[model samples]
Target: MSRTLSVLFILVCYVIQGQSQQVDQDSIKNLRLNILPVVFYTPETGLGYGALGLSTFRLKGEELSTRPSSVQLGITFTSKKQFLMFMPYEFYLDEEKWRFKGELGYYKYFYNFYGVGMDSREEDKELYTADFPRFRLAAYREIFQDFSIGLGYEFDGYHVLEPEPDGLLDTSLDIIGKEGGTISNIGFLALYDTRDNIFHPTKGWYVEGAFYHSARWLGSNYSYQKIELDTRYYQQIKGNVILATNLFLGTRSNGTPFQDLNYLGTKRTRGFDNRRYLDKNEVSLATELRFPLYKRLKGAVFGATGTVIPSLDQTFKASYKGAVGGGLRYIVNKKEGTRLRVDYGISGDGGQFYFTINEAF
Candidate 1:
């Protein structure tokens, strides 16, 4: 039942922008403001949490070069300590509009939870220690004028404080791979956007599809395959209001050795963790009404629903899976109608609040 799509509040992924086919007549030191806030909750893994995050974007010229790059920073807050992260994203484009890009990223999650959110058992008092400094590398290429492809790899091997005598205890809650463990994954990514631009969302369609697998130094002894599909549409309503609708469909293979069921996260769901429940397939739908109130203010209200199954063939079980929620939204950049956002939602168990940039497409 973990297949229910939940949108955790804080940090997540990025959809790369390829090299443009044509140059702009003029360009400038374009600036973009960004923010992301997330929170996690689970009845089985104890009470979970999210990181505190703030971000900004600075790009030199939109017309001077077909390829562009951006810089980002983020932070995470758990039960123990604090964490910081930094990222640099670079991209290239060819005459045929084929886009090539790469990204470097690092994240450190500091905390003191010796044993939390691990499993169904709570009797063991044994504990281990660890600190992780993960390095991530990603590349994206644009193929077929209508389709863009992407790939990413990362290795995280911080440290486990010290293993306890019980033989099965650790300091971190991550079960897929612990602090002493190095988790890595490679992905096949693609996106199709029929809009004026990727950042400035006006009116058009957007679609994203990706497949990912993990290995040893990359992640415990398990390997998993995930297929995700997302689609969105925007329409201008009367009185200058806009209507937005989005759908997400995803599924994971149960063959992964180090992985739990794929819990839907921020991308498709609005109020759940990536591992709350486990299932093979998930489906989500969301619709919103947005109104620009000021030059820097916009408001929105939306509803979302999703469900997960152990497999595509068993997608209709009504057991302990999935979630649903609805909440209000605030927008920045009413002029171009782009920039930042804040959201709040209520699910089957509780409610969640989140903040971020872009239109959530």
Candidate 2:
């Protein structure tokens, strides 16, 4: 537990983005601008982080479905860590409101550490730098009442980081040979989400399924030939309460491809280091419970478990391992439709506590 605390991470408050045009009757459409600012702390890294994000929407008169499209831009910075992100995305809604077409225009992520390799002997220590440009184009269709199915092609990857000097541990990663590679998966997907609405804080169930082929590219896990299945569920207990869950099952002919692209920090599991469980085959599960404490303020509790096996050839079962904890979520702005979520949870293995955004799914 001391080691976890020693990492010096700060609690992070997640703020969602942007708005719709609320204007008088206009020409073909109305344009609106939406922006969001976020601040967070990492108790493990003793780091402070901030983000500014914006979105532009085109509305067709008062039809709501007349002009269905939006563009987004965002940037992130940190005080303790040097990592940053610049993202731009575009989305489109069909005239019938039955489908959503979208694409992430650009995604640029830069990762940096304060004291990585000071070893004078290792020349590669200086080469420690990672960044990537990624994008995805997806379309969602209303399969049932509020349920939906989605399909798309995605390309995400890591900018190459240089090898560490011999005998020196690269703070950038675990395996010494990892150079941070690019991964692209062209596939199909299906999803179902019913959360009252996409803009405000209402809860329901959300499930997703995706399949892709790496075609021997950076996206290929061990050596291409990969498939992944992901599912999620969110429920509102009475009215002000919520419960969330996540499940993932994936494998590649050689292994899985998307696991290695995690270049930033621990996103899901608290007890284990980020990307610690990447293997030929992987399975993971997580859950969370939340309730509203007061106007603009909410609290939550969560837990998680996951593991990786060497191959699909061998049948491996999950041991249901993870963490548990709780935190507060403040509805920072009603007009902005933004919420600042700060959650803390501990892992089952060592009961390590962690705090972060959303529901950890």
Candidate 3:
């Protein structure tokens, strides 16, 4: 079976098993825990198996109105010798006045590289393997209603195990991070959010801006600065129907690694291969229409357009890429409004599928 399909089947099994499992609840601690097994198949990975544990809780003295915090831990290994271990957590403290979120993980994985610009051709695609340990942490405190200022630190120790001989990485002396290296950065962010719901917003605005710098003094192999801005708006069109729009902007300094450059594809731009187009600057815009399909089920149609360029001045002149797609959502946690999302996107090259546990943005 195809990798995506096999994963979907496993997720379906998980849903069935999840419904029958008894959640461990501690009333005194206001915590609930669920543990499950993961299994899937794919041509590249052969058989993959893992375990996942998730815990949701409210801090002591925190009112029920405060958002519930969650921590997820997972470990997986595949027959082809790939493996991953990770912990991701999000917490709301002080009655929503403070928020903290981050992830720590290590993984051995493969990625497709197709040169590093909008003009890159599909024929240049090459697969490479790498292993990396990553750490990311962010803390935010609301200064006033719905406005927050934050600080964050991130680290990634990347080691390329295999690079295609005679390929771009091997042939190009200009490519930074060709051998993989450490990326450490500290950043500051400002956010303004008014969305009524974090999982599925019906109406409101979310705007965020951040700046980070990685330098030799900070244990980074390369020195560079990056700036990013993301803005989103949601509006209720009618009963149970909503329209959402997003715009993203990013730029990095000269010494930035190719892997760290802004890209045209990610969760932000569906339908295209991940990091299909990479450069020093990028601008993207997307919109989605969401509506209820049935009880606890939702549907969405989205479109996006973006471009990557070496500099901001060339943004308008750069070749643009676009995509259109649709997706389904099944609510998994009613209280938290979390949903299992499945989307299929189409672009000039072909179709791409995505499956996950939350909205793209």
Candidate 4:
């Protein structure tokens, strides 16, 4: 896995280096492809390597489409033997009346567990290995202007490959479905979106809500229900400056597995480690200030506060954690506002650097 990722990284560098001299203005079209190499270092995963490719297109050409449909493929491998491969796609059909979006992935993750609640400490790190193949599909049809309703199906199979010795998995918490299980659920989705550009929205709002349930009849190892709400707003403060904000909330019923629970990290808590905190319920509120620097270059400052609790009944306590960071962006595809992002996120635990495509939101 490491060798393959290394080779992929090298190939992407070679291709990008040669792209500038071969640029052709007359060949410009609705189809755009962006590729980049990913490299990061973390204590848990050691040196990680990967590659990501994003393809965006529109049937009616970029001028007529409100937002270009996209497909993303990404993979990563670490010295710890952790592996991940994901392919996600979004499509618009029939003049934007119908929409399809989902993802399929395989993962062998060396996940760290620090118990199951907000009070869990960093010293409680327990390394566990889990292998899984997951997929979800959602299709929506527009019912009103800027509003859509849809249905989705999801399947996740989790197998515990290794459990930490004398660690939280067996000693501290008796988490549901710890031994491995399958979750099969059907969900309902509703979305309201008015973003001018999906890649880099200047002024608009996007809101989504979803409800899902898993039952014995659905081949689920356990029965549970989940609800998620995500809303984002963007405003052009001035020329070449935009303000973006996001609010996200998620909750699940009892008997939910740890994997299904919400965590503060990665996309939500940029400064913290991915999945650093876990619980049945979570809330995150964040904002980013984006502005241009030099030509084809941009910068953003972002900060977020979030927390996870075992139940929705918990008061919005002050135990909330926070992460703040700034990032640099280089416009990879100026026509579509596609960018390559490099960020350094810092929290009380420490800091982590990220490299990838597209905005954090």
Candidate 5:
């Protein structure tokens, strides 16, 4: 019952200004700005309208071979009276030896939650409204070719604005985070990336592992730990044809909050409701076949399977979910390989459409 259609009107403007004469002349020091007005529809949000802006630029002495850094901002409001504002950015500094990325966002939104675990029934769905502010920051220094290690901080202040009367969230004593609270965590990150291009990689591998711990001493209401591993591979098959695949594994300690539990049906799974299943552990694998269609336009077909388990011992006995989808991509920034993506996915429950800025992985 989830769907989105984003009509994008793009405006691109380039600004060229000289900094100090001391700046390196070999650097490409121009800024490119793209603005798009977006309109979309979803059963949960009704009709939504928004504006998305992206600014891409290179630092003073950075070479063209280095990936360009980008800052993206978005604001949206729905007819249902929900709204969201977010800013996400990525920077490649010091000749691409240092990488910094994160997101800062505030959401006044509604989410559907079923009772936790794979056994949760579809009929048990409940809608809840919440407002929250989120901040995440990570910095990594390349230790070797295509390898880096880093540290990150994450924080979220979540408050429930509305909960269904007599619903599971209101009555269930087993549910943690039913009455939202602060979530503060510190984490370690390791990444090994060899992609030819940041936006659209035709060949390479990207592997990342992260571990995070949240404790009362860290200003968290609950104490828990989380571990996640995401691995991706991309390869060119033939002329203008590419194959991309991803596998993600995640697990959390027993004390993890319900909101922090592993779930399918996000950008990761795409076809089910958001947080369709929740549990302490999860495994998902997806693959896509990408090929050129026309000038500035590309096409892709993707399939994914995933499952969530309440405990590690139950992993082998878990019920799995599957999704299949196809989408179109329009190259928004040809030089940087940035694209506008629109995808429609189908699952056992139903189908959903997604509109976004980049690849799901």
Candidate 6:
């Protein structure tokens, strides 16, 4: 459940001092800051509170860059005793020709599991606690106008904090990496991005395809391979109205660990539990219609459908699950078109409220 609710109150004094002033592409600049206090409640994590601060600026004082680079830091604690601290950052250099992006986080939290496949029943739900530190780092070089190729490495170390005695994970003898181990993978990335701004886009397309391989030489506890393709399209339908769509497909092979396999939930299947359905392959599609409601306010209607399969060979044989919802958006940074979003999505199982910064895509 990646839900979050943020209430943003701009520091008016700073805005009046010219922080909101528009500067030409060739002018000197100061960094822009966006900060918000978060408060939200979910059944899984109980009441969570946190703050996120984002700083955006040009690199090497180059104001004509395609987009401003940004660094975001956040921390949160839930009433259920879950704690998380994270930093995500993106940097553009050499006149936006080179890019670096990644995230690092440490978490002590509880997660639920429903056995190992799409057919796993809700009645089989069980909970356990774990502590982990995860990190990913990537660098890309632009090879064309809006296309780039890159390489990235990721590390995830999981340590069981409260083992559930006789639970599925504790009883399953075939599940490798279950007792807590390190997973390290290095991969290649290819991307094509044409969005006017990374935070919000009225018209553009963003596509990425990548593959990663874990090997013994890389100090990984298990060896496996994974591949994914994600594409998103945005278009302005009329005055202040935009339509957005996304398609995502992913699969893993070569003795991939249970935790590393593709799963359906979270960002891809909003109404379901995070990773509620697990398997080696998954496919999902989502669409949303967004339009202005009033000054600084927006409304959206969205729907999504997805499914998980044990293997690529069984792709279409599985049943598809769906979710639909509506949301309200409050423009936080009109200059950059960033917004705070609140959505309520429902599936056959039930509904869940989601709050977050920017669009889900």
lDDT head-to-head 3 vs 5, winner: 5
Off by over 4 Å in 4: 1-29, 41-43, 60-63
- Candidate-wise lDDT, in order: 0.50, 0.50, 0.81, 0.80, 0.83, 0.78
* lDDT value, candidate 4, whole model: 0.80
**Cα lDDT for residue 75, model 4?**
95
In candidate 3, which residue ranges exceed 4 Å CA deviation? 1-12, 16-29, 32-42, 51-54
Model 4: weakest 10-residue lDDT segment is: 1-10
Pairs in clash, predicted candidate 3:
none
lDDT (tens digit, per residue) of candidate 6 on 334-353: 66666677888878766667
List pairs with backbone clashes in candidate 5: none
Candidate 4, 1-361: lDDT as tens digits: 1211222322122114213222243532366677777776555677788888887766543344456678888899989888999988888877788889999899998877777777888887777888999898999999999999999988899865567877678664568877789989899999999998888899999999999999578789988999999999999999989999999999999989888889987675787776788999898898999999999889999999998987777746538888899998888777678778777777786766667778888
TM-score, prediction 2:
0.68
Q: How many clashing residue pairs are found in candidate 4?
A: 0
Regions of candidate 1 where Cα sits further than 4 Å from its true position: 1-28, 31-70, 76-79, 86-131, 134-138, 154-180, 215-220, 257-261, 265-267, 318-338
Please identify which of the two predictions, 5 or 6, would achieve the higher lDDT against the true structure.
5
Candidate 1 vs 5: which has more lDDT: 5
**Clash count list over all predictions:** 29, 30, 0, 0, 0, 0
lDDT of 2 by residue, 190-246 (tens): 776555434333466666666666645544333455566667666777877777777
lDDT of 5 by residue, 1-361 (tens): 4432233322232223222232344653656666677876666778778877776778777787899888888899999999999999999889899999999999999988888987788888988998999898999999999999999988888865577999987899988888888889999999999999888889999999999999568788878899999999999999979999999999999778787899998877888878888899999999999999999899999999999997777767779999999998887777787777888888987777777777887
| Tens-digit lDDT string for candidate 3 (1-361) | 2223434434432542233222333332456555656776655566788876666677665676777788878788988899888998888888889989899999897677888888899888787787999898989999999999999888888765578999987788988888889999999989898998876888999999999989577799989999999999999999989999999999998988876889876877898877788999999999999999999999999999999988999978889989999999887667667676788887786667776666888
